[model samples]
Target: MWYRISSSTVIWVANREIPINSTSGVLKLTTSGTLNIFRNTSDLTPIWSSNASFSVQNPVAELRENGNFVIREENDDNPVSFFWQSFDHPTDTLFSGMKLGKNFVTGQEWYLSCWKNSDDPAQGEYTYRLDPTGYPHNVIMKGQNLTFQTGAWNGVRFSGRPKSSGNTMYTHKVVINKEEVYYMFEQINSSVSRLMINQSGKGQRWTWLQQAQKWSILYEVPSDNCDNYNICGAYGDCNINNGPVCGCLEKFVPIDVDAWTKGDWGSGCTRKKPLDCQKGDGFRKYSHIKEPDTLSTWIDERINLKECKKSCLRNCSCMAYASLNISKGETGCLQWFGDLKDIREVSEGGADLFIRVAFSDSDREKNKATFIISLSVVGGVCLLGLPLAFCIWKIIKKKSKLKRSKGILQGSPKGILRGSSKEHSNMSQKEDPDLPYFSLTTLLHATNNFANSNKIGQGGFGPVFKGILEDGQQVAVKCLSETSTQGTNEFMNEVKFIAKLQHRNLVRLLGYCTDEENKMLIYEYMPNKSLDWHIFNEFRNKLLDWPKRFHIIDGIARGLLYLHQDSRLRIVHRDLKASNILLDVKMDAKISDFGTARSFRENETTASTNQLAGTFGYMPPEYALDGILSVKSDVFSFGVLALETVCGKRNREFIHSDHLQHLSGHAWRLHREGRTLELVHQNISQESDYALEMIRTIHIALLCVQQSREERPDMATVVLMLGSNGELPMPSQPGFFTEGNIVGSDADDNTLLEGR
Candidate 1:
């Protein structure tokens, strides 16, 4: 019969027909290796039996650390041939080293079922098991109905669980081998803790306190109502900060407004404008967002952040994506193809989500029209009284001519070449008679009639061609483009400004030929071509290692330092960039293409203009927005070029999330997060110890590009910072936060606001 250990506690006996009803009822193993129970003085009964499957002479049962009771064969030391084991028939508690999924091949299902109650040990309604359906994920069930889930396991953690830190009490591991899949955890130090699936279908951890001889609650899964099954319904983010604690994304609105207002948000939300692939649809990046569920349809584990966007954009079905594993250099990509469900805005450390939007050309045209109208208004206000200004300009021109003629008369040469006679006659009347003039025919023949193959490169001024004179001297001939937007006045301005300047870093103007349609400037031919060709080209980028790259960066800085401070005229190369840096055969960098160059008096700091012109990405925010040009304009462009050199990527083509439009802003974010190393190009050698120094250079480049002209560092200080080993000042936040477009503003007001 069954024995009642206490009047309130009941214990079961396998062979209950025979009862041992004495105080000396002892169940003991005899020397014959047989276990028997003796009740009274002469009464004996067989309470239990063991038929050890092993042929070994001896066997014994022991409780393992995993809490499994197994009888092992002494000689074979094999527990597989156990006569009896608690694992094959489990009790109420499923401890650390337990298996909980089905053994499909063996037809043996291992699961954790809750007890009827604390006082009863019968099976309960709730059960937990690992589901191997579309993907392997954990599921809890109550009476065959899905109750809770632990989401799919990413490489690092469960997808549903928020990333956790500062939990050092235990180490956890989830293993899936050929035989079974299980969840387990080990204590960091010797502490008594147990995890249990309670009677009410809740999972919890409890730790024992030896002094109090009691158990203390540690943690519980499925912590809140949002954690309940689809509580906010689909495509709805749960936020504890909000009143109702649930809402749709920016471009989305509630599908059932009445239900949502009544606090019944189960129907969730829908898109305001349905995505149409035919239109110019694009993704809007949502940062610090908990990615949605139901990702099995669109997840790709191999692409990078850029590639992930491309993959999503290419396939119209993909709605969003987040990093599957964000810890170790973004190992995997998780994308959502259709509907996004259970999204949340976390306080910190969440992935970015891109949502699709309708694309319409009319919207673009309207934006362009608005920009032109605004520019026209600003330009008109700045250029009022134009005819009166022209009269003043003519009077100045007359006085300038008189002074030039006086200088020409004082410096006329004795000899003039034969072909240059009548043209030379015109030169004698000109103001600057000592100005060297080369014949158009001579320059044309010297440059092989400006052959296409001989053309080295082109700038705003024109195409530069390689040539060899009769004396076997190599030179580059820059022929002004006939169809160029720049006029003769701008060309003459450059010739006049750069002709008198002489520096090793500046491209020397050998001579100029202006006869009829042929206008060309000749200079010493640089064999290595422009710096952009080598530094930015994918195949050639590797040639510039850290040492060579740093050397180039330093050389360019020095050249700029000379232009801004050391030179007699405080000149600014408004278009300073990699394309403007010409490299000699030895790769010595020389600044070229001074078409957009400007000069200032010694005491002057900046100049204002209504015209806005420069390459798109290289233009500083202040100069691009408000037509205020200054030395800082050149500084901003240099910053972009410097970053491009380090990463071997173009600023315009850099692909961060939709929130971050350019490389400078992306680099700034990573730098502030103390993860600037992630910005280094993958091809850069890791063995080098200059990574930190490279980051410093990148920081300085960012400082130079600060949106406010006043915020940018001066050239003198930039040169010193680059050359010195001293500690650098912290840089301010860069331009372009996660807001609307920052374009279409004027330079003066923009610079002033940014400085404030």
Candidate 2:
């Protein structure tokens, strides 16, 4: 909001947090020639000043075209020879070529601090800059906490930022040549472009598009959950494509299984076998990874990879070492002395890091070879029994046939799945015959070996691809990564629960497969994909008319009812939310993603757990806050989903001008004002039919999301309320939707908030 004659808006304020309330406000040069902002009401009150304690003999100030306001000696007309400049200290916005780090000689720190909120210019929690210590990784900090981290300088760009390397739009660098350490970006095109650190701490680079009369987002950092700092603690690695997300490096185990099982990885992993420290100690190479936190790291440019490893091995205290520069084929040395933290495996763009461990952990291979030879000699004599081999083949054929009988086949990926135990067959666990399986070859051909074109999207679980089988049937394939922390537990949950479920409203689980290393699930594809895609997308929302939206709401209710009461297993779909609701070609809704589903006996309906995992916004107050779950928990999520559908907005990401918490808060406000219809999506309004049904549906949604779990309506009653012309009960305020005391905008803005 900076300006022209038509509007005198200050786009960038020098002292934004301080307001000059009276017309008596004045900007003047003092007797000593230092400039300051002052008001008549309080002569001594200085809102802002040049900080020139000993003023120059002749001082002058000027605003450069690049938006730098500088004060310097009048005799020195050169712009670069300035005493002070506004660009040196930033507030929320960063322009091209701004130094954002340290002037070591002067002990000065320059960084970007976010405004309090979107409109308030007061300082907020987020700060972005080069943290000069431990080799200067660009970081985004929320107060004292590290929210995000970029690549450590790898002699090129930040080593972890693939996007920053080889970019034509701008040249980026981290300069640390003794006098200072700083990070700065020089744009190829500087006009009308600014990189803003939004109030939410998102680093967004916007370039104006004259033709579209809009700002285009070039890219942003903390792009996904993996960018979160120390998401996986010491000796653990984070892969966003994994369930439970955090996992230990090979041979390490969770320090606390109870906490990790409940989705807490803070007490990460410890060595299965501790290092013997130079006594039969060896370095295990970890490829394709972002290095751990460098708080206690040492770096030297003069050494090569060979010298680096030797130096680390020479020191008993050194825990790990890596090449300093990723660009130059593993050159230079970077060493960590103590605990390793904040490590993650990258899908692409990462360096190789080697961790030292004891040789005892590798001794199993030598012992296993001896065991194999002894077994081979014994099996030679057993081969004389031919009739037994035929019997074994017959039993396997029978099992294979039974697997195909249900229109789903089960098998392991060829040469991919290893029993993690033996040579005859690699079976990690006892094979379950309840669900059918799909062979890896079949799925590979169906999805082009999981090609990018076929990829629909990725979630915490892994990458999902849309595939076409030989029978002309389209299916969605979930390729479970071997490194995924979900392990076998979540996979079995989806298999056990979705297999026996028979309902039009529920997603059909065609089958599942486990190759030597690959784990996959085949589900019937939905042409319309997930509910969130259509409802939250502004352009797509127009396509979903009021009738279609109402239909979806009804379908979701029926699906939830089936889960709560009609299903063979009295199951609770614990992770229900918009993204979990898949839509078929005709826009019919189906409840999906049964990975978190839990079944209870009819007599036993409620359960509790210490840790929680689910999208945040749709989680019930009782379930989320206290871990009590039941059919009512699903009902609470349904309430949020239904409300979002009607409003064509997301509960978690909703923004309000009035400072309301989210969509639910705004809806509650509208309900009290007798203007609930105003909460409906603008696109849905053109078709005025079903206006009354729309209003009634919003009321029912409110009843479903009431703060008290006992007051909320069950899914069965919700269906009756929607289908029949019945009066809805008065609803209380929804959970997490107050005007004050909210953590984030969306309920399930889907952070690793489960740990909280």
Candidate 3:
């Protein structure tokens, strides 16, 4: 076994199966182009051999970076030269870049066999491999008895494991040629990944986190009940979200609805009416469905979906048909004959399947489709009219808004104002020397001229769109909206401030775009969008479990602490809310939208001004009413954001069952009543272990949003309280707990878009 510094754990084991009681084993390459593993015993017999008979001039054996031990010619005469390689005979671990399939000509099969036990090197009963007996699909077996199967690849990804398609850490590829068929994944960056089949028969992907100095689970197989083969029986779609987890396809009925309702779903569905092979017999297309089992299916590589459908129609035995790969155009055909077994309906996996149905059912479906098309025509007309009317109204609004914007520009701007647009652009380049300058042409092409399809959301300053650079790097482009009240000052404030700051929890400013007509900033794109994107929605909130929510709270606290003390200069994020918190692929929260942020010197603890800015619900009483600003103002906002994350509801949008108090007041009441856990997001509070952690979070939130600035803890103290298990001070009444008492409660927060 070989070890490395990043991790002391065993990375590679040479002589896995053969054990020597005394002298152990020695792995060496022979004089010939062959590698062997031999146990150092009195008998002196080689236990494992590369078995390479091919001869090469000046042959040498070496191990490559990808953990491939190969014996090949020394020179570059033959680049593809490989007499033998250890990758051909993998033990249990499947490292990234290693192929997991078979070579037809060589008759060599590549698969991952589970280790017998933690201490044993023998292969176990479970085997995870690509089965090419039929249409290719990754499968798991318990000594030849199939347990789980990832539905065959449909061009983009496996029908069952759709998430394998768009993983950020790695990209998976499959190749089928005249000689070989294999599946391999390559890491996008220099990240170490390992796929191991455990002794229990489960396969999991682990990715090394350089910062955390540990590995995280990227994915796993057989994750749920639906993953089990034939769980829902034949001709039934399994949906884990469903209570029964199984349901009959359209135009079909349960074999025994009584048994099905009683949780005995072994007997799957049957057609209500048999297909008569009549001229009107047609297929019903089901979208977002996991294609049926492919063990007994027929596939044609040359034909398209249309050709496949024709073929299925001609063969009366064909039960269902679907396109093999819909990643691009419809290419290849897969037809399932007889009964469709192990079918599934997933939220976001697989392609559409067209199943055969009786003529009567087809006619009814046609009639329904006709009615829907007619209704859609009416709806389409209304939609077109609404957009036209909205555009006209928007034009008028834009003109009036333009007049107001010009009116503000007529006078010289005061404090916290940039000298001018020209100075704002020049000074940022001078001050933020490390910041990249993206040309307008480059940005325009990257964002498709700010196409609506690419637009992710709107901020106070402009529209934020997701863009891809020429290098395939995805970024969020924040272009200044023509009607935006935020101009030179706020723009420069963010560019200069965030450009100087560096932290994982702080949104990184990749670059900026400046021109006569455009003022734009480029940032690392957040795939999961803002915190408000999830918490404000009932269904999406489920994605944020208590652990994830707590993680975000902790991250936000650390980010705030960095801004207050750790950074080169003390910074205050004036606009901190759910909408301002962006989540990365790992669900790590990053504080974004720093256009309204302020900076304080080392000795400055507080600052006061007549200019009051920030969202209503998040602003503290002192900051909103008295125009006093400090680290506490940001702390108050953090408190509100934390409450929103835990409650799974917006601060201002909170609707109480008992009374009409805001979210903060609701939390205070719950705390006083010894029911602080009740205020937690319903989706997360189900776990008893995390109940205490959640209650403590709510307590910290209350302490941060205290009515008086003096009572609120500093960002450092808040971070300590969140990290340690130490007792916290009792929280007083939080500001803005009541709607009427909130300053600018009814006014638009967009007014704060412009700094004083």
Best by lDDT: 3
**What digit string (tens of lDDT, one per residue) describes model 3 on residues 1-756?**
432534544445556676554566776777777767776644457887777777766778887777777788788556456877778888777887788899999898999888777666678899989888767788889997888888878877888764443467777878878798998988777777888787667777778868656555655667555777887778887865454568887778889889988877779998888778956577778876677778778888889998998899899888888897777688899988778887776544567888889866764579888999999977876878977867877898887556333422212121211123554567667777788998756776787766666777777776787788897577998877666668777888888799999998999999997643357899998766788877786656765666567878988998999999999979998888888899865567899988878899889989987766577788787877778889999999999899989988777777877887889988998898898988877777786657778889899999998888899899989987886679988999888767677535422234562333
Model 1, C-alpha of 244: deviation from truth (Å) = 64
lDDT of each: 0.64, 0.74, 0.77
- Segments of candidate 1 deviating more than 4 angstroms: 1-435, 685-687, 737-756
lDDT of 1 by residue, 1-756 (tens): 111222332222222335444466665544334445556445565554443333435656566655566655556555465555656544334445555566656666666666666544566787766665434556667888776666555555555555555656665656665666656566666565556666667665666556534444454444434445555777787753354568877767899999999988889888777777755466776765555554354556667777886777677877766565555776566667667766665433456666665543223445777999999976875687678667877998897566433322112211110112235335532744445677655665676666665766766665677777787567888766644556556666667667767786788778776554345677877755677776666655654556456657777887888888888878888777777788653355788777668898998887777765566567776676666788888888888888888888777667776455578888788888898777777767462457767888888998887767788898888877886667877777655533334543221110112321
lDDT of 3 at 476: 94
Candidate 2 lDDT by residue in tens digits, 109-145: 8888887864567788898888887878888899998
TM-score of each: 0.42, 0.54, 0.55
TM-score of 3: 0.55
Query: Alpha-carbon error at 30 in model 3, in Å?
Result: 2.9
CA lDDT for candidate 1: 0.64
What's the C-alpha lDDT at position 233 in model 1?
Answer: 70
Which of the predicted structures, 1 or 2, would earn the higher TM-score when compared with the native?
Answer: 2
